[model samples]
Target chain A: MTEHGEQREVFLGRVRAALGHTQTIVPDEPPAVDEALVRLATHDDDLITMFCDRAASVGMHVDRITADELVDQIVAKLVELDAKWIVVGFDSLDQADALNNAIEAADIQIVNWLAGGATMDVQFDTDVGVTDVHAALAETGSLICNVDAKHSRGLSLIPPVHIAIVGARQILPDMLDYFATQHDATGIALPSSQAIISGPSKTADIEGQLVTGVHGPGKVFVYVVEDV
Target chain B: MSASTTSLTLKGHDILFPPLPYDMHARADLATGDDQLQRFINNATLSKDLQRREVCAQTFGDNYDAMRSLAAEIKQHTLDHLDHYLEQFVDAATGTGAHVHFAATAQQANEICVGIAKREKLTQCVKSKSMVTEEMRLVPALVKVGVEVVETDLGEFIIQIDDDAPSHIVAPMIHKDRTAVARAFERELGSPYTENPQELTQIARNHLREKYRTADLGICGANFLVARTGSAVICTNEGNGRLCTSVPRVQVAIVGIEKLVPDMNHLAVLLKLLARSSLGQPITVYNHIMTGPKRKHELDGPEQMHIILVDNGRTEILREETREMLRCIRCGACLNACPVYRKLGGHAYGAVYSGPIGALITPMFKGLDKYPDLPHASSLCGACYEACPVKINIPKYLIQLRAQMVRRRITKWPDRLFYGLWGMSLRHPATYRFGGWVQKQMFRAKARAAGTAGRGDRYTDRGWLSKAPGPLAGWTRARDLPTPPSNSFRYWWKMRS
Candidate 1:
């Protein structure tokens, strides 16, 4: 067994030789970049309009509602989809009074993924999965979901349909803005996985024909609450 | 397990250059035989090209060129200080509870992966679509050691069952018709054959869902490795990438060393161009940035995370002239744009990488002698350069490879001698005009003998030469060689003057 230290040295040596470097060249300071960052620096377009337009273009259905109407909206959407059983992320628990009241009002069976003891089979069998987006990008109409204890990765993936609720303020202009604001606030490190889902899972692999719901959710709904 | 306990085992994983499964001319002949298949290839590439243009225009607006230039600059900078960035990635990934390993060759990479599986006592493995893993032939290596590996991506699943290689980079089964997939599933999975694409996808999903649920190991490839955060970013339209990374107890990512960006800011730049160029989507369904194993407080994710940085032939590509080939993001935009690729298709290339980028890098990665014909595959029309997201000057590299072949005497002696004579004639004006006059007379005689008069400058206007003498016969074989004009251009210019 070769030592990791020795292997590292040999690999770096080969890379240096290949690059024709006899001594380590210190990396120069990066430019105070101006192009993409500045272009997407601010949101001139209406966030709600831009988000809904981009989201709908990629096949995600979007609805707008105020925080006071959130419970009624959830109940209505669930009733409309005929969702009998659903799994919700723990991060949504802070609005438990409204969501729980809605779930009870709709008379649907629900499991909190963050509450623990939920198996993959249970998550897979659920009628719908719900989660809150950490941030949303209008440029690509993607929902950036960070996986943590409260937010299980499967909440947005395992079920055939995913419903993501995002605050109006969470919608950013583009991916550049999301990274600039999100990364500066939190350090450079990321979670184990951060999924930026633009739409329901889709594939055109078989004969170049488009098919949705291949492996992930087929139907995705985004409810951008106005007053969070 | 502690980092000290992890050991490097060097097995005999040297670069293995397999002979072409079939001859290029034979594949081209086969492609010519099936008109429907040819049309399929044509339609698929054409539609993808059109969609890419439409989406890129919509997404980037007027900033498309500027974004591509910035992307190219980012890749160039990362490659220039690759050693520094790689070291930084290693430190950061290790700090994030990921065990990082380096393999100098494909054999070593496979051995390292097998060693990890053996150590972890993993039995079943699920994989996402990773061209690097395909290049390394990782599945066969694992199966040889009694590890059952299932490809979870629907396209990869179809090809895996049929024991076929990928025909396209992003869409692996683009060459296959629905009937072929229906047949493969019926034979392999013992299901009723269905030609409906939706049914076929459902069949694959139902079949692979169990693998995702029960697999002990998950393997994937990174589209880009974030140097600042020690993250391996995978972009996929299907959510299999998420499943593969999140379901298995142990996950391993096999990444080429060239796939690196400085930070999240740079990652944002590449994210805009990747899907827009490949599949015409604003973004793929799932872009998973996996930093390490399941974090201390995380509920779901692999418990053990391993990253194998494979340097099979990338370090060699980093040297001097051919280094630009490493900037490829594998978007397959160039493949859709290349006229030769549209006609002959990926099978004719007979390499893991195909099309313009393939033509450029295959010779470098697999050696010039191994794939002597790849560089000649291009029409040199510069469409690939125009479509390239990173704007790799594929024509420049193709020309360089051809020159290297000529200098090394890898080309045939007759071709060399013919070009040599042609070059000498072109150097002197008198010889050039005399040679042209001789060529015109020969063509006029051939035209007259064929009972056709040479009346126009266009080759098609004159009678086609079904057969020709000497080196020109190859050209006449597939195409009609237009007879030269009765008067040379120099003669006409002389008369006018």
Candidate 2:
């Protein structure tokens, strides 16, 4: 390991010791997660069009989804988005395998999310980064991603295009519900940096003119999947 | 910049310097340029005026006022029950393993921050754009104790180089153009003189990159403090806030006592309204929630975290009738929507908080009696009240402050005489009509004489309507006013009838 890597390990070790080996969650069931499909079925065409209209506002696309063929649709959506290079979280290996197979078929590179490594170098060059979300908020149409061993929060943020793959069952109604889930899960322990990304990075600071991709991902893609 | 005389003009009146009976609105007026100031005020007021109307149309439609009232009611509820929510916040934050410190004043807050810095033995501190620090003058205090503080925000960095203050709350250097920034950056950073904004941005990014990595301390301001998670949310367009918080060994968040919200739900609503109100955006470039220092098994984040809840005369403000000023979200809406602000910009206010809000706040912080002149600085247009999201009745507060100044005998004797005389004339109809007629005759006689003499150059006739004399002379120094008609509106209507 490099000097910085060694120092990080020592620091992590100290933090782990300070935490006192408290097991917050027993993991009886895998954490439920979801990516909200805004226009799944809505009578208001204006609302639907507005959703799709802002799709390009943040460099995201509104892909129509069918209840069946969840895996196929997600993989196809990633391919169609022209993402040649991709990153996925450790917890997302099951979906990542299917995605990897599709990418292999298309002759693309798939970078797995590592707890520790030189991921910063690849962040600039990576076309797309994927993460298995903690939960998806339906009210704001937001994706809740946190820093953890499995999630590797950097990938969700650092890449130009972030394609978050989430289970449809994980959708929460609002921030209050999500907070309840977090409290019950961790019993008051907070995540380091909890990012609630509603859309791609945007700004209107200069003369009140809207500009996208100022700092964070220019684009955000959510691929909703069913339970395997 | 040593301790110069505290004596200064406020608005347009002149008074004795040093330990005045009231706040100097005359002093501020003297310091500010009436002509140059008009342009700034017009620009801010007009732009915000149009943008607010546009935003209202797009979102609330006719229900804009209703929504604004609702938002105000919610904020008022939150403020009234602040102690309960704050206790809950402290409980939740401590439960999450983060340390929270309470400070009752700016000195206490600075000491707490400095203590944290001293404990860490930090030499370098990088900061994001935070108005709270500007209020406390945190950088100067920190620098006095030997910490090399660097501001990472682009506008802040530009102002720091020029040794200048923020001219606008949001856009700190709005008065400066691209070429001026390019020159400043080139001279300071020794970078190329690239006039392109993109290049300038890249230069700033490159320059700030090293500071972020090397800095031992990261200081930030909270847009909203979520009481539920014990988290401080910073919303910024630049990635520097993220870098500063993420890379530093120790992260310190300095926030006002009024910044707290009950929970994430309330936080969400404010965030949505904040971006839209300030810049008309769906979101900022970064919305970072740092709950505490790095947790076990976490790779990147500060090892230590501290939150300094600075009261800094805020509680004192709450005790007074000026508690509405605390409701300011620092979105610069008042600044953008103010007529006087667009003309004078922020620097002319001569206080950290500028614009109409500054006019209201400056006096309160330094003692209103010292700044009695500030309250009279406004035309009482009520534009600021219209622009405010929480609906702070600024004009009402201003008028109340003025009344207080007069009651305290802070105003000059001339104003009292003028106002008393003016009030008496209105009370008696005969005297009112007689005074009106005499004033009309004097104005007409002066106009007839000037028109006969100056002919085409009527504007140069200085004493035309300016014969009132004394402190009011400043108004006529720049421009001429039109002559009043010989007959009153009543007389004209009577003649027509």
Candidate 3:
């Protein structure tokens, strides 16, 4: 065995010794799903308003609209911002047909951020990037995105401006509610990389002065469609 | 060798405990001299503390304490069953194509990382702000082996360039003003001097952006490791966490074993408190839950992922008395709330971790003999406990550390003698009165001598000792020692009754 492997056994042995456990002790079972849902239900009311208010407070531009109007709103916002090039995740294209059509109709150059699609340079050069949020937290105004083969991480990160389309029904009350929904008795399946983005990139590192657009997107727009 | 070995050398790798470059008093003096830096630390920490209060109240409302209790309980439970959770995490992380390594010491951890870099033939290693990496002192190790490691966080980058240690955990360069940063940048980066924070941040962004593009390795520290999902959750405000994780071909996260949450449910509880307590943000700009390397069909992300679970001295701290220190999420709320830390700054602690938590842990991790002064640094104020998101009773631990110090006879002779005598006298009322009478007489003699020597203060016509003789001189050096009353408090009480 390698030194690290030996160290691993020894470390685990020491941990067991410290805790007075000689053998592997299985953890207690997680709470039931219905119990978790009951706890989640307590914070179910006023989620959209809370999410919008919290999102706006953290420098994210939030707009609520019907699902039918999401494409027009996104296209209009892109035009308003004068974005010439946009990159989008494959998941967004697979999920939102109207959004895809609207991007084509708006005459904006769109790059697909998949493995055989857009390169890192193309994503870096894009003016706007859009992705559909898997879930959102109302209390923190966070948008959750899970990165996989179809949903490239850079689609939402590299652009100067990012437009996240969060379905109103997908918004959870808080991180607890989000986690409760993710848990299962056997195991929780997670993506390679899951991001909980609260707002635009910012830093107070330089003399404690807050500055945005350090490396990631400077402007983040969240379009909350009431219907999915 | 037993795992409880205290030797500085571990597994053919030399664990270093370099002597503090400067004494605490010197750093305190420097902090005092720089009014701007002092004001900056004070304002920044105070503002963060205020914001943390407001946001936590606004978000959790009456459930704030309940959330903290749940977080603490989860941490304690996970720690108790750490072996199971760690094995589970390793299995799940490996199941997702991540290679897991274990390091029993800082040297071993550095060696593991250096070994990876060598195997990959990595040239540039980009890193986000990770206090564990700072504690491991990994950059110098990597640099020693001809691998150029660049700190991508703006504050860490500035301090790294300046060859200075981080003064604050969250804000590494909190002690540095704009002028200092501009000077450092001009001297090091050969950039034109500019004091504007936005411009400075832009310069760093432009510089690091190029490094990110070409860097072959990305290193980070995990804020929390979810056992159920096998993810390393990294939270950051500057988005460096995302860039570091995504841009590099090889990514490594060096996490302390105590950073585990039982599941994502526990992680949710911690996430709520972590940001609010650290920066008063509802949440950081990016909270990336990285499970492993890039998938086979992913466009970008590390092709190889490695998670090094480092023990160093953490396993020692997992003992019953000091286990609470492991609950720290490195949010640095305790540091911001500590009065001693606020006045002296982080460098004064002379450890990678500073502030109240630092004081408590340093003694345990580095041995009470080596860092005996840390336990005495605090005034036993419970502000750190109140501010701690996990609600680690820091003052309680500090008092425990002091008791351990006393029991071990590690305290200085004079201090031990003084406290011992005081304790004995307090046990007996007659002896206490007699000791007070003797103290009063001694003070009267000093006052008479000062008056006769024409050293009386004009304002109150009283003799105040400017400098005291003997062991008490340590107290009187910076302040006057007022004369004690001739009549003892007990005597006065008896007469009145």
Candidate 4:
């Protein structure tokens, strides 16, 4: 095996020598690209402008709140929307229950997953679906979801109106860095699919006109949870 | 598993194998520097190269290694336990109202497809670019039975018009420039003279749109068949694959049995590798997954969905040592990276499939004995293996095929005698020295008599007397012959020592 490896190295050496010159193989160094993400996280005001701008483009309302005020704000919003049922992610169940209790004046049910189950009931039975964002790209203002047994694939996709709670620290520099994190964190193996969704399901396949929510969610709302 | 099934699979697989003695001399002559194909191959390769680099750089940056390694692992896990996923996928697909059929051979697969076409009494069938269909020669089967088949993919459409098979797997017309395409369109479609690619695409789209609306049957290939949902996943740049599956009343996906994976989770992995490797896109334009025919109240979808799981020779391929070829996602990454493929283009390989993957697949699909010449076509640079998204050791397979060729002893007696003599001379110092001495004496005599020793040897009746004798005839066919020197480098080096 060692001899075989040596022979391959020798063959490669010959090919490279015949070609002349060599480029250094370096890892852990950036390939001289603009790091636009540094600006997105520079100040509290800059972060607010980022979310507000993305929300305007996607045609969604934006609101800001403290970590302590989250449960009250969420319950009040669900009540205003007349949410009969709420579907929460696997890890978000406890927080979701706290919000449900805050709005105990109205009865609401919560499904535990975001796959087919969320879609089946959420469309009619539930008024809002809450999810924890895996990461967020400031450049695209897109919420990322990394699917696993804990996080159902459908959470960010199937709901008509999706409310993603993105922790500020989960923000990545760009789409690539976000995906790279997923790849790196997953070790050498990855899942069959790791979709990098910039927005809701969209298509212009017919007549080349933009239409959102063709198959996936029609509306997406990201709540950028600020540090206490 | 039975002998009858095995034989049927082998024969079906045999259908895609290139002709014996491989018409490589002609192909090699054309591909080496064919001015006609230079622009086409150059443009296609350059575009793929730039796009792949840009996308990986932009997305993964320094993390390209992590992405590649992750993608490989995902696919490996899916393939390792395919049977479990296959069952689950079938159950899920059937649950969603899709029908699945397992075909152990191309004949069986075709019969199942033709059976559906026959039952429907379909007269016209529209298809997208599918290697499995090419492997089965599906169009010929349909043609034999008086069914008209239309290739909707732009590249497939161009080749179909000329009654030509696909040369390159991805960019099938990589060997044909815009002029040739314009000519083909002029002759076939009576299209007005224009050499623009966009114009050609518009013409094709306009033509195929009409067929899609009225087609009786839609035939396509599956990139991944999620065993959990039994859904057929297809990724296409053009939306024709989408239209083919949805618009037609009967949608049939003919897929290799190996395309099956455990679930949608596994589907995600293959998609990542496929997109970045093939087109350098984060995602293809359309990733359509069809469950079954449309539901009772559903607005758009096929009325009947039938998936024919083809073994063809795949089961045999599974049994063989080249089972890794089955793990291929059909991304054509190996083809783009191959230096020999870049030079020869795709035509030299001379089969529906071409390039490193094609070289490995062609022989294994057929028998190595019949396509023995193909294994020798490569320089064994190992570029294909390095470039393979899944990291398939393509050169190792090529070398194995070479050994198989030697075992079969397909070379003629004259060639055998020449090689044997050369091998014997290489091993024996005394005989080699004697031969070397004889060549030196002849060269020295010729140079002395010529009176212009600096100018070299005289020309004989046949031509220049570099004196390489008999069957070196093939070597000087397109090159200038060099006159043998009085003393070889080995002798000079020995004297210096």
Clashing pairs in 1: B13-B107
Candidate 1, residue B446: CA error in Å?
Answer: 5.6
The interface root mean square deviation of candidate 2 comes to 11.8
Chain A vs. native, model 4, TM-score: 0.65
* TM-score of predicted chain B, candidate 4: 0.84
DockQ of each: 0.57, 0.14, 0.54, 0.03
Which of candidates 2 and 4 is the stronger one according to DockQ? Answer: 2
TM-score per model over all chains: 0.93, 0.78, 0.92, 0.64
Sorted on DockQ, best first, the list reads 1, 3, 2, 4
Minimal lDDT window, size 10, model 1 chain B: B6-15
Give all candidates' CA lDDT scores: 0.82, 0.65, 0.80, 0.61
Docking class of 4: incorrect
Docking class of 3: medium
What is residue B242's positional error in candidate 2, in angstroms? 2.9
Per-residue lDDT over B1-497 for candidate 4, one digit per residue giving the tens place of the 0 to 100 score: 44223222222224234345454555666567677566556656666766777776775576665555555555554444444455566566667666777665567667777778887788788887788888777887887777788887666787778665566777676666667667888899988977766566556655765676677788999888865456678876555575566556788888876787554444555665686788665555456656566665333346788877666666556543555677788888778777777777776665667888888887787777656667877889986776666678889988888776666787556877787787777788897887677755665565455543445334332123433445776665666454555456877999998
Model 2 chain B: lowest-lDDT 10 consecutive positions: B9-18
Of the candidates shown, which would achieve the greatest TM-score relative to the real structure? 1
For residues A152-172, write the lDDT of model 4, one tens digit per residue.
444554455667776666666
For lDDT, candidate 1 versus 4, the one ahead is 1
> What tens digits encode model 3's per-residue C-alpha lDDT throughout B1-497?
32223321221112224352213454456666777767888888888888888988876677777777767777888887889999999888888889999888888999899989998899898899888887788998999999998898888898888766687889888888888889988999888999999999888887887888888999999899998778999999888889999988999999999999877867777776788899988678899999889887776789999999988888888877677789999999998888888777876676777899988887777887777778878988799998888789989888888899899998878888988988988898889877787876676577677773335455334456777766788899789887664455766888997
